[model samples]
Target: MGTFKIEGGHQLKGSIQPQGAKNEALQILCAVLLTPEVVTINNIPDIVDVNKLIKLLGNLGVKIEKIGKGSYTFQADEVDLEYLESDAFKVDGRGLRGSIMIVGPLLARFGKGYIPKPGGDKIGRRRLDTHFEGLINLGAKFRYSKEEQFYGVEADRLKGTYMLLEEASVTGTANIVMAAVLAEGQTTIYNAACEPYLQQLCKMLNRMGAKISGVGSNMLIIDGVESLGGTDHTMLPDMIEIGSWIGLAAMTKSELTIKNVSWNDLGIIPSVFRKLGITVEKQGDDIHIPAHTNGYEIQSFIDGSILTISDAPWPGFTPDLLSIVLVVATQARGSVLIHQKMFESRLFFVDKLIDMGAKIILCDPHRATVIGHDFKSTLKAMTMTSPDIRAGISLLIAALSAKGTSTIQNIEQIDRGYENIDERLRAIGAKIERVE
Candidate 1:
C-alpha cells in the first residue's frame, strides 16, 4: 500500500501550476481512436487513470508516443477492435467512469463496441442508462448478458437524431457526443453537460472536422462527417485541482499563488469560494491567495443565518469538488451544510474529519453540516485511508491543515486524478512525504 505522511500547520508559501485536466485527457484519448491521423495531445495529465487509459489504447493497437512531459502523440489509425473483446480491455475499463465513453467512439468507427461493466467512484447508481439510451436512439443495437454483466453494441451506420438525456451526466454527454460525431445526419443533444471538460472535448472533436454547436451550453448540435482527421490540442488546466489548492491554502492560512489557471473557464467557482469568505485575486492567468493572518469570515445568509453548500449538475458547483469545499469549510468561522445530492455515499468521510476534532454532523449519507473552528482548535491529524479521488484530495487538505503529522493510505486513489500532486504541494512548501 502507498501512503503520504504530511506534517500540518505550516503555511503554504509559494507558486504552483495545475496539471492538464484528468477528465479532459481521458475523453480526448478515447476520441483519438475515432481518427486515423496522428493525434498530438499536449498538456495531458500523467495521472494513473490516464495511464490506464493509455495502456488500454495501446492494447487496442494505438501507437502512443511520449512527446514530452504531460504530452503524447497518439496514433490509433490501426487499432484492432478485437482487443476491445479481451479481458485486458475489461479490466482497464473497470477503473474509470470515462471508460464507458470508449464504446461510442469504437462503435461509430468499427460498427461494433464491446466491453464489460465500467467502474469508477462508487458514489451512487451512476447509471449508464442515458449513455446506452443515447446510442440506442442513434440506431445502435445492444446485447447484454446478465450473468457476464458485459455489453456489446453494434451498428451498420449510426444515424443521428435528437436526444433528451435522462440526466446531464458528464461522461454520458461526452459518450453520446463521440458517437454522434461520426454518425449520419445532424445530432442534437439536449440537457447536455456544458462543463469545461466537455467543452474541451467538443473543441477537440471540432478540430478533427466534426461540426459541433453549443460548445458551452446545455444544448449540443453535431453534424456528422465522413471521417475525422487528427489535430494537435492542449488539454485544459484542471479547475478541480485549482479549487483544491484554494481550499488547502485557505484552511492552512497559506500565501499561495496558482499560476496559469484558466480563469475564464472557472465559472461559478470564484463566487462559490466567496461564500466561504476566501478572497482570491486574479492576476492575469494566476490566482493569488494572501496569507489570512486574520482568518476570512464566512458570510451568512440574508437574515444573517447559516448557509448550506451543496452540489447539483453542471452550472452548479461540481460534486467532485464538494468534498474539498467541505474540508475547507471545517476551518471557516461559520457553519454550512454540504448536501451532496448526486452521490448518496460521498459524505461518509465526514466521520474521519469529526475524528480529527472537526465539528461535523453527518446528517445522512448525502448531507453533512460543518461548524468551523475559525482556526482556534487545532486539528490532531491521524492515519487515514483515501476512499475516492476527490475525497482523497479533500482529506489531504484536511491533513495539511491539522496540527500533527498524518498518514494517508491508498495513494492510487489520489493518483487517479492529480498529477504530481506531492511535488506540486511540496513546491508550495507542503510537508508531504510519499512512502511505499
Candidate 2:
C-alpha cells in the first residue's frame, strides 16, 4: 500500500488547475462503445479508476491510442463480445464501480451485455438495481447469477418507453440515456439527474447524431437514431476537486488561485462554502481564495438558528464535498452541522479528526456536528488510514493544517480520483510526498 508523508502547518501558494471531471470521464468513456467511428476525447484525467476502465475496454478489443497528455482516441470497431464470458473479465470488471456503465452501451450496439458485481468505495450500499431496472424498462431482458454474482442484459432490439426513475441517480440516468439513444422510438426519462456531467454526456451524444432534448433539465427526451457517429469531446474541470482546494486554502490560511473552473456549472458550491465563512472570489473563469488570517465564521439562518448544510439533487450542494466541508469547519469561528444524506458511513472518519484534537460529535451514521476551535487550538498530527476517496482527501487536508508531521496509509484511494495530487500540491508550496 502507498502512503503520504505530510509536514503540517505549512501555507500553500501559487495556482492549481483542477483535473477533468472523474464522474464525467467515466460516462463519456463508456459512450465510446456506442459508435464504431473514431472518438477523440481530451482532458482525460490519468487516474486509476478511469485508466482501469480504459484497459478493460482495450481488452474487449477497442482500439485505443494516446494522442497527447490527457487525450485519447478510441474506436470500438471490432469489439470481442466473447471476451465478456472470460474469467479475466470477471476479475477486471469487479475492480471498479464505473465498469457497470459499459453494459448499457454494449447492450445498445450489440445484442448482449454482462458484468460482474462491481466494486468501489466501502462507504455504503450503492445498489445496481437502478442501472439494471432502467435497462429493463427499455425492453431489455435482465438476469442475475447468484452463484457468480454476475448481471446480464440481452435484447434483439430495444424499444423506447417512458420511465420515472426511483431516484435521481447520476450514473443510472447516464446509462439509460446511452441505451435509449439507439432504441427504436422516442424515450422520455422523468426525474433524471441534471448534474453538469450528465448534461455534458447528453450534449456529447447529441453531437454524435443522437436526438436528445432538455439538455439541462430533469425531463430528458431521446429519439432513437439508426446509428451514432463519433465526435470530439472535452471534459469539464472536476468541481469536487475545486471545492477541495477551496477548503484546503481556508483551513491552512493560504492564498491560492484555482484556474479555469467553470463558474456557472458550479451550482451552490461557492455559496455553500461562503456559508462556512470562506472567501470564494471569482476572477473571470478562475476562483481566488484569500488567506483566512483571522479564521472564518459560520452563518446562521435568518431566524438565528444554527446552520445546517445538507446534500440533495442537482442545484443543491454535492454530497462528495461534505467531507471537505466538515474538515474545514473544524477551524472555523462557529459551529455547523454536516448532514450526509446520500451515503451512510462517510461521517465515520470524524473519529480520526477527533483524535487530532478537533471537537466533533458523530451525531449518527448520517450526520456530524463540528464545533470550530476558531484556530485558537491547532490540531495535533497523528497517523491514520484513508477510508475512501473523499475522506482520504479530507484527512490529507486536515494533516496539512495540523501542528506536526502526519502519515496517511492507503493513499491509493486518494489516487483513484485526484490526478497527480501530491505532485500538484507540491507545485503550490505544499509539503507532501508519496512513499511506498
Candidate 3:
C-alpha cells in the first residue's frame, strides 16, 4: 500500500487548480457508451476510479484514444457484448463503483447489461437498488445472481415512464437519465438529484441529440431519441476538492488561491465554509482563501444556538466534504456539529483526529461534535490509515496542519479521487511526499 509522509505545521502558498469532478467524470465516461460516434471528453482527471472505468470500457471494446493531457476520445461502436459474461469482466467490473452506471447505457443501446457487485469506499451501505430499480422502471427486466453477486438487465426496447425516486441519488438519477434518453417515449423523473454533475450529464446528452429539459431542477424530462451522436464535453472543477483546499488553507493558516472554481455551481459550499469562520473570497472564477492567522470562529444561529452543519440533497452542503469540515473545525475558534445524513460510517474517522489531540465527540455514527482548539493547541502528529477517499484527504489535511511529521497508510484511497495530490500540494509549498 502507498503512504503519504507529511511534514506538518508548514503554511502553503501559491495557488492550486481543482481537478475535473470525479463524480461527473464517472457519469460522463459512462455516457460515452450511449453513442456510437466519437465522444471527446476534456478535463478528465487522471485518478484511479475514473481510469479504472476508462480501462473497463476499453476492455469492453470501446475504442479509446488519448488526445491530450486530461482529454480522451471514445467510440463504443464495436462494443463486445459477449465480454460481459466473461470471468475477466466480473473482476474488472467489480473494481469500480462507477461500473454499475455502464449497465444503464448498455441496456439502453444494446439488449443486455451485466455487472458484478460493484466495490468502492467502505463508508456504508451504498445500495445498488436505486440503479437497478430505476432501470427496471424503464421497462428493463432485472435479475440478480446471489451466488455470484452479479446483476443483469435485459430488454428488447425500453419504453419511457414517469418515476418518482425514493431518494434523490445522484448516480441513480444519472443512470436513469442515460437509459431514458434512448427509450421509446418521454420519461419524467421526479424527486431527482439536481446536483451540477447531473445537470452536466443532462446538458451533455442534450448536446449529443438527446432531448432533455429542466436542466437544473429536481424534475427532469427526457424524450427518447432514436440514436445519440457524438459531442465534445468538458468537466467542471471538483467542488469537493475545492472545499478540501479551502479547509486546508484555513487549518494551516495559509493564503492559497483555488483557480477556476465555477463559483455559481458551488452552491452552499462557500457559505458553509464561511460559517466555520473561513474566508472564502471570490476572485472572478477563482476562490482566494486568506490566511486565518488568528483562527476562525464558528457562526451561531440567529437565535444564538450552536451551529450545526448538515448534508442534504443539492443546494445543501455536500456529504463528501463533511469530513473536511470536521477536520477544519478542529482548529476553529468555536464549536460546530457535523451531521452526515447520507453515510453512516463517515464519522468514524474522528477517533484518529482525537488521537491527534483534537477535542472531538463522536456523537454517533451519523454525527460528530468538534470543539475547536482555536489554534491555541496544535494537533500532535500520529500515524494513521485512510478508511475512504474523503476521510483520507481529511486526514491528510489534519496531518498537514499538525505539529511534527505524520504518516498516512493506504493513500490509494486518496489517489482514487485527487490527481497527483502530493505533487500538487508541493507546488503550493506543502511538505508532502508519496512513499511507496
Candidate 4:
C-alpha cells in the first residue's frame, strides 16, 4: 500500500553497501531450527520477507534475540511443534516462499514437518515437487491435502539415500540438505544447486557439526549426525542488489561504487553487465561502475549477431536479474534479447518500460527484445504498479533516470527484498520519497 515518488534525472554518486543476501539468509535462518544450541547470524538484511521468516521462527517457539543491528541469535531448544497446525501458523507460513524451507529442518529434528502452500512473487510456476520428492527419497512419507491446501511429511526415522533432483532447484536442495543432515545414514544429492546461497548454507551446516562435503559443486554428500551445535555465520552481499545498482548507475549515467560485494562470489554477474557495454571495474573488494555519459553500447556476439541474454541454472546468469538487465538495455546502443527461461511470466513488465518510450517487443511470456534508444529519447515519467520484487527494482531504476516525476505504487513488493532502499538511495543523492 506504499508508493515511491521519485524525481528522475538525478546523477547519483558516491558509494553504497549491498544488503545481506535475502535468498541465503532465508536458508541460513531456517537452518537455525536444526540445532538446539544458540546460532548467531550476522549481516542479516532488514527486509520484509526475512523479517517475516524471523517472526515465523519466533512463532514456532524458536527463542530469537536481536543482539545487534543486522544480527540475531536463535535457539530452538523449546519448539512448539503443535503450533505448525494452527491457523496462525498457516497464515504466517503462506506469506513468503522461504517459509517452506523450515519443513526440512523441522522434519529432520522432530520427525515431522508441515507447511501450507507458500507464497511469493507471481513470476512463474515454482513447484514444491523437488522438495517433497527429495524428502520422500530420504525415507520420509509425504502427504498433501487438497481441501486443506497443506503439505505434511512424517517419518518414524528418516534414512538418508541418494537423490538426483529433477532440476537443480535452489530452495529444494537446501531443504533436502537440511533434512538429510540429521537423518540416520549417508545421503548424496547430484545436480544440486551450487549457488553461493546453497554453498554458504552447506558451509554453515558443516561448522555446526553436519557432515557435508562438496560445498561448491553440483553434487553434495551428507552424513546424518546425532546433534548439531551453535555456530556463527555471516551472509554474502546481495548479488541481485549489486546488479541492480550497476544497472541503476549505468542508466542514470552516474559513478557508483558498490562496497563489500564479495566479487569472487559474484560469478558471471559483472561480466554479464559488461556485455551490455557497461564499464565494470574491480576496486579491491568493491565494484566501481563509471558513468556512461556518452551512453553504453551492447556488444554483439562473435558472429556479429544481436546480443541475447538468458538465464540458466548455477554459474549461468541468474533469472532474478534479467529484469534489471532488460531495463539497463533500454539505454544501451544496440538491441538485446532478454530471455528469462525459468520464469514464464516475468517478461510482462516490458510494457511499463515500453510506456516510458523504450522500444521493446515482448516475444512471449519468457522473452523480450529491446532496441536500445541509445540516449536519443529520454524516458518520460509515468505512474506504474510494481508486479514483483525484481520488476519493482527495475522500474525504480528506470524512474531514477527518467525525464520527470514517476510514481511507483505497490512498493511493498520492493521492500520485500531491498533493505531501506529509499533511505539508502537518498544517502547517495537520489531524489526519492516514500509515502504511505
> lDDT per residue, candidate 2, 1-436, as tens digits?
9999999999999999999999999999999999999999999999999999999999999999999999999999999999999999999999999999999999999978999999999998898888889999999999999999999999999999999999999999999999999999999999999999999999999999999999899999999999999999999999999999999999999999999999989999999999999999999999999999989999999998889999999988999999999999999989999999999988999999999999999989999999999999999999999999999999999999998999999999999999999999999998998998
Across residues 264-293, which tens digit of lDDT does each residue of candidate 3 receive?
A: 999999999999988899999999999889
lDDT of 2: 0.96
Model with the higher TM-score, candidate 1 or 2? 2
lDDT of each: 0.89, 0.96, 0.95, 0.95
Residue 324 lDDT, candidate 4, scale 0-100: 98
C-alpha RMSD of each candidate structure in angstroms: 1.1, 0.6, 0.6, 0.6
Score candidate 1 by TM-score against the native.
0.98
By lDDT, is 1 or 2 better? 2
Model 1, span 1-436: residue lDDT tens: 8899999989989888888988888788899989889999999888888888888888889999997887789888798877777777777777666778789999899998877888887677778788889999999999998876788889999998998988998888998999999999999999999998999999989989999999999999999998999899998899899998898889999888999999988888878898899989999999998888788777888997788778878789988899998998887888998899998988888888989999998888988888989988978899988998998999999999899999999988999888889988887788999999
Give the TM-score (vs. native) of candidate 2. Answer: 0.99
